[model samples]
Target: MSDKKHKTLCAYVEEELQVKDAKSFISLIQPATHFCEGCGRSVAKPEDVCKPKKLK
Candidate 1:
């Protein structure tokens, strides 16, 4: 899957799991997904803080 398509916490975790296992995992953890208020980017984990990129 392309990284751009996985724009959510559940999507990231889902990528690491089998189709059969994903449902169970989602139900178990029920992670609180967050989206960046500034750029509308989905934050997969709590530590996913937004940082400015340095231009070359």
Candidate 2:
């Protein structure tokens, strides 16, 4: 593996979904999944962000 440290940067993607039983049809924000550049792993949700630190 490379010595490059993996960091979890803040990121998001826009998504649209159909809703049932709506009056005026308002928009909703949903949690999106993101991938890590170093590990190439998928982050579960936006709330659970993995913040990594650099080694001096």
Candidate 3:
């Protein structure tokens, strides 16, 4: 039995932000940053990396 907890990338980012270390953390994960590379706009979530399709 192991006593370890797993956290998603977003969860870790949120924790770093809460502790006022978001800038440093952001730099570390910049390659995986979820944003609009076209316009340099930051996205709200990591899942937002992919655009969703609309159904008619």
Listed in order, each prediction's TM-score against the native is 0.28, 0.24, 0.26
Pairs that collide in candidate 3 are none
Q: What is each predicted model's overall lDDT from 0 to 1? A: 0.43, 0.30, 0.44
Tens-place lDDT per residue, model 1, 1-56, is 33453234344454664365666445433443554454443443543424322222
Better structure of 2 and 3 per lDDT = 3
Ten consecutive residues with minimal summed lDDT in candidate 1?
A: 47-56
For residue 10, what is the lDDT in candidate 2? 29
| Least accurate 10 contiguous residues by lDDT in model 3 | 47-56
Candidate 2: regions farther than 4 A off: 1-32, 46-56
Which lDDT tens digits does candidate 2 get at residues 1-56?
A: 12255323222221111233122112111222454445443444432235422222
Indicate the residue-level lDDT of 3 in model 1.
45
Instruction: Kindly list the per-residue Cα lDDT of model 3 for residues 1-56, writing each as its tens digit.
Output: 02166433445545664357766545534554455444333444444333422211
Give the Cα-based TM-score of candidate 2 against the true structure.
0.24
Candidate 2 has which clashing residue pairs, if any?
none
